[model samples]
Target: MLWVKSLHIIFVVAWFAGLFYLPRIFVNLAMETEAASRQRLLLMARKLFRFMTLLAVPAIVFGLWLFLGYGIGKGPGQGWMHAKLALVLVLIGYHHGCGVLLRKFERGVNTRSHVFYRWFNELPVLVLAAVVILVVVKPF
Candidate 1:
């Protein structure tokens, strides 16, 4: 069980690292104005997004297993587990949003700006931080 928990934590960290970095790549990609440059950026973004998605699956599965197998209940009112769950949902939304954006990019849409991506990138970081705090500190 402890090994499972450790693996879960490691995978979650790996997933978060990818999540945080992919958006930064998006920010740069959005800045490219030339067609060739944009295409290159799109390719990179696609690969990175795919990688992140792959990482996310195991992290989520392991996390669910940890939560269920370890008997860690959803936190009580105003509890840390509740906060973590909320942030996890937000992360899920962020992941889905990335998928939407990736699909749009693949379709040759060129509407998103670097500024937009930069701001968007901050969201996952914030949510990940909240999750880490909730898990580590268990603050209520």
Candidate 2:
């Protein structure tokens, strides 16, 4: 269980790192006027998204193992766990949203501004903060 927890943390951290950077790349992509630079940023976004998705899989798997196998959050007074799970779902949606945005950029159809991506990049930071607080403080 401890090992699983460690792996979960590791993968989650790795995934979040990608989540954090990908949008910044998007910010660059949105602002970049040069074709070569745009292509490079697109390639970076593609690779990062793929790697992040790989990390997310084991992170989710170990998280489920903790929830179901180890019973990390069961029964009464576990509202924090439920909240955390909801936020996790939101994070998943945000991850998918990133992919959607990436595809838009790839298609040369991205209409959003760098400022928009600047704001978009902040979502994961806020989610990560809330999740850490939920896990560590268990604030229900």
List TM-score per model, in order: 0.89, 0.99
Off by over 4 Å in 1: 74-78
User: Candidate 1's residue-wise lDDT over 62-128, tens digit each?
Assistant: 7788778776745354477766777888888888888888787778684978899889888877787
Worst 10 residues of 1 by lDDT: 70-79
CA lDDT of 83 in candidate 2? 95
* Location of the lowest summed lDDT over 10 successive residues in candidate 2: 131-140
> Which number leads on lDDT?
2
Per-residue lDDT of 3 in model 2: 97
lDDT of 2 at 93: 98
Top TM-score: which candidate number? Answer: 2
Please state the error at residue 25 of candidate 1 in Å.
1.9
**Candidate 2 overall Cα lDDT vs. reference?**
0.96
For residues 24-99, write the lDDT of model 2, one tens digit per residue: 9999999999999999999999999999999999999999999999999888999999999999999999999999
Give the RMSD in angstroms, all C-alphas superposed, for model 2: 0.6
